[model samples]
Target: MIAVCQFGGSNCDRDAVLALRHLGFEAERVWHADGLPAEADGVVLPGGFSYGDYLRAGAMAARAPILREVCDAAERGVPVLGICNGAQVGTETGLVPGAFTTNASARFRCEHVHLRVENAETPWTAGFEPGEVLTLPIAHGEGRFEIAEDTLADLDDDRVLFRYCNEAGAVTDAANPNGSVDGVAGLLGEHEHTAVLMPHPERATLPDLGGTDGRTILRGFASEAEG
Candidate 1:
């Protein structure tokens, strides 16, 4: 079963559960205070303004006691995916690198954007091919990714997972909706089994919603569990 972590302000918990079930996975929303289920095979930090985005997007929730269990599971190689606000929590908890800060536009951006697959080998991206473009929706005011120069260089060598890009798959400033450094949209964690992204993959998983490109992203969990 997959555990969808739900904090006080998380709005995407149900959406995440629905998306995962649609893809043939057993999933349930697990309240933050309830802690992780031992039966959980994977975990997802769905998007939303956890703790009302207090003290920064995810600072409060990152310090939640439940995350300690989440961190332990991650260290044991359990697949963990953090989307949007969840991505912020992941970084705040040191589950992932870099930070999602104020957008370059300094305003909330909510729309469809293209993301180019930078590395297709990781469990989170194995469904895609290098240079493949995916249409995903992003809605956030503080989604810019910031990392140090040396860290950026290391991420380059580690082969970061996703980057904002044009329809033609060109990484350009104009295509960057959040002004993330190097157009980074997603990144793998210290362990490849974990990842975080600012885009709403769960929102894009239903065909009726628009496109199902996001399904591939969620598939990463099942892939890792099976392996």
Candidate 2:
């Protein structure tokens, strides 16, 4: 089973579970305090205003008691996928690199944006071809990815899961929705099994709710379940 964690303000936990179940996977919303189940083969930190964005988007949730268990699971090779607010939590918890701060516009962005698959080898992007373009929505005010130039330069290209891009798959500032550094929209941790992205794949998982361009990302859980 896949465990979709629910923080105090995690409105997306149910959406994540529903989307995963739509794809034929067993998913449940495990409350933050309730703890993750031993049967959970995968974990999801879905988008939301966790702790009402206290301190920062995900700072509070990062320090939650259950996060420790999540980290332990990740270290043990369990797959962990973080989205939007969860992406912020992932960075705060050191699951991935870089920081998600205010957008370049300093305002919330909510609309469809294009993304380029940067690393097709990762489980998160294995369904798409290299440089494939996907349309996903962004709804966040603090989605910019801030990283030191030196640190950004050292990031392995293979670890970059996705980058904002034009419809033709060109990485350009014009196509960047949140002004994330290097147009990064998603990134993998040391292992492909761990990753975070600011886009809400759950929102796009339903056939009629939004475009299904994100089903492949969520499908990663099924792969882990089989293992």
Candidate 3:
């Protein structure tokens, strides 16, 4: 069973559940306070407005009781996927590093962005071709990725995924929607299991909805969890 964590202010839990179901996985929403379900095979931290975006986007939500459980599970190599605010929580919990701060523009922006797969080896991006152009929606103000140069080097060494320009496959400000250093939009954990991405894959799971680009990303996770 795949575990989908639901927390106060987490608005995308249902969308995540639906996506997982569409991919034919058994997924359950484990409440923020409840310990992670014992039967979970993997976990997901869906996008949302956790804690009313108080104390910084995911700061308060990271301290939730169940997050500790999620952290523990991740240490044991259970896969975790954090999207948008969920990505923020992962950073706060230290399951993933870095923080989301106000966008360079200083306001929320919503639009479709083009992304190139920089690391296709990650479970989530396994089905996507290296350098593939994928269109996905991004809505956030504090999404820039801040990390030390050494840490960025380490991520590259470990194959942590990142988003690059669809045209040149370069990490630059133009391709970076939120001023994230090096155009970092996603991360694959050191173990290469957990992944956090700012773009909304759940929102683009259907072709009729103007996309099927997410099918590979979501399907890759569900397939690996079952295996």
TM-scores for all candidates: the values are: 0.97, 0.97, 0.94
Stretches of candidate 1 above 4 Å error?
none
The lDDT leader among the candidates is 1
Determine which window of 10 residues in candidate 1 has minimal summed lDDT. Answer: 151-160
Report the error of model 3 at residue 177, Å.
1.2
Better of 2 and 3 by lDDT: 2
After superposition, the stretches of candidate 2 with alpha carbons farther than 4 Å from their true spots are: none
The true-structure Cα RMSD of candidate 1 reads: 1.0
Cα lDDT for residue 115, candidate 1: 95
The residue-level lDDT of candidate 1 at 147 comes to 92
Note the residue pairs that clash in candidate 2: none
Q: Can you give the lDDT of residue 169 in candidate 3?
A: 64
Clash pairs, model 1 backbone: none
